[model samples]
Target: MTDRHNAFLSDMAEATRLTQSGRLGEATALIQRRLGVPGRSPDGASPADASAGPHAVPRLEGPAARLGTEAAAATAHEALIPERLRENIDQMMQGLRTLAPSLRGLVGGGLHAPKPGGLEPEGVETEGGQFVERSFSNAAGARDYKLFIPSPRSGPRPLLVMLHGCTQSPDDFAAGTRMNALAEEEGIYVVYPRQSSRANAQRCWNWFEPGDQGREMGEAGIVAGLVRAICTEHPIDRSRIYIAGLSAGGAAAANIARAYPDLFAGLGVHSGLAAGCARDLPSALSAMRVGAPGAAEPGGAAGFGAGSVTQNLRVPTIVFHGEGDGTVHPRNADAVLAQAGIDALTPRRERGSSGRHSYTRTRYADETGRVQVEAWSVQGAGHAWLGGSPEGSYTDPSGPDASRAMLDFFLGHSLPGGRG
Candidate 1:
């Protein structure tokens, strides 16, 4: 076996040992560090820097090795060893050994094969609006993000905060959703806060980590600070501020909406789990694989911290999920809806078609007839942005336009106290 493969095996063995010794946290952290996952460090250190300390291990090389590392890392915390992990490792090893020279060349060159449709065209600067690169820094840490200001900007415009999925960039997400185009039409300001690869190798928001889940700490605080910074710099309507995301980003959005209900008028979560669904890497994997039970209620004195109580407010929410999604189970959408505190109400269901995808949409309303929650189940869509452009990554072009629907729902709601 190659030296890289040997190192991969060594790390896996060590992680398994650590977990067996009840050092689940350390084992998980080791895996994340070895796999180059970002934001695992507490002091805002880069993964490379954090991994370079005394406990750091050698890095695994090649895509197959990386995949093996992730699988092995995941198995460390399991009460019983999973047969699937071994099977996957064996399959990957055999596949890597048999890979053609041409394919190997492509992999070595960063897997930069041009995607179909070329959604992210080369040399394209801006489209339908202006994209300004900005940074927000506070006590929690500094993060870089992009802000899209539509043309003919006037008045206190509504602000939409969008979080991208794992391994996706703000630009890719913007292209897929075409949110900027819609924002231009509606005269809205859109912000896409990028989750750095230095923070998580997958460029995913660390929503599953307990540190990033609560208010005024970790990533949640940084994101909220970014919002406050934007509002202070621009003429944004605080009462109409909204947040939405897909996958990991979607989960983070839900966490933020839950922790800081007063800051967001509405939230959109597409293929995401409910807030506090998972507090560790193992639980997160379980939640993603099989879906977790929904939270008891939106707000009932039980807050993120033991003593603090979350505000008694429910932000209007919209959820979209594909029944065919293999990455994240469809039941996660149901859990998110339940977390919005809309399970008691009967939903108004409607069947709709967009592009080549058919979907059923259900809306839950309050006693005042205000729609509090909406859920969309796309029949044949997979783990992707519904009705998104093909040019972007992990997007399904056939489903109903989730971006438009989410925006409509967001625009209809405002903070109860009209923004603090």
Candidate 2:
């Protein structure tokens, strides 16, 4: 093997170890530098801009230095990161390249990176509606959120809580999904909760952690608290609240919705895994690569922390996944559907095209013929918000309009005694 290839492998192994240790910032920094991304310092901060940049990678010492030796390094590389995982690692790094520029502006209190299409910054009042910023704090913790209130507020409006993916901010998410634009059309309220980098270096929700997976705890508690606070302050209908997210955010949305079924009437999970799919970094990577182990067996919901997975979904749910998504395997989408134990034989299927991409949509109904779960599988799309705008990050604009579809599905159902 070439010496250069060996060095690359060594770095890849180290990056994998860092990721397993939950030091994603350092791992991101190392990977970003290896990719030759400009404007970033070795510590993962941008020299020109403190707000956006990669997280710093720390030097190995003592016990950590064993990986520097050829023998120990080989063993660690072989044992911890198998040959099969290399492809996934490469794909993830490539995704980082696309995400790096927007990332510098997203972290800490840095100025937002410039919007691609010269769009207005997030939370700016536009012609369509008023975008307002707010904060919520409870015993669990505190979080910042942006609320999009439609221009014409006639009565109690339905609310949608949006969670952005890693390396994303509320404004970036708003621009990508264009959910705020849809809110203007439907006369509803949309809120995007900002995940702080202090909680996670990449600003991803701690979905794989045991504490964050259950109801009234960790990130779930904070998000639920935010929703309650919004409902109390605004003219929101308690019965018509919903939540949706993408990638890491998507997994979090599943956990939050499942944890607090009483708070959310419906859920939209795009390119996400099932709730409690993984309890740690190793299992999380495994679940993202494949479906959660034993997820199909009866009573397989153990190790899910406080709550066990139930057979039926308490809240109406819809899912979206790209067939070509490399960062997260498409089977995770199936796992999300499988969590509800929907019968495989009953779904009604349809094939359609959204401008450039082809898609297959499957709908599953309850005994009353109410569509309780829906899945959209888009062809040729990757780990991005399908049919999202180019103005934001991590979006593919040519696929099906997931924002609109999710809105339609969410509006179709409400809590009991609610106007559906």
Which candidate achieves the best TM-score against the true structure?
2
How does each model score on lDDT? 0.70, 0.72
Which candidate should be chosen as best, given lDDT against the real structure?
2
TM-score of each: 0.67, 0.70
Tens digits of per-residue lDDT, candidate 1, 258-280, equal 87888999999988777777766
Clashes of each: 6, 4
Q: After superposition, how far is residue 68 of candidate 2 from its true place, in Å?
A: 24
lDDT (C-alpha) at residue 160 in model 1: 97
TM-score of 2: 0.70
Clashing pairs in 1: 37-201, 38-199, 38-200, 38-201, 39-199, 119-391
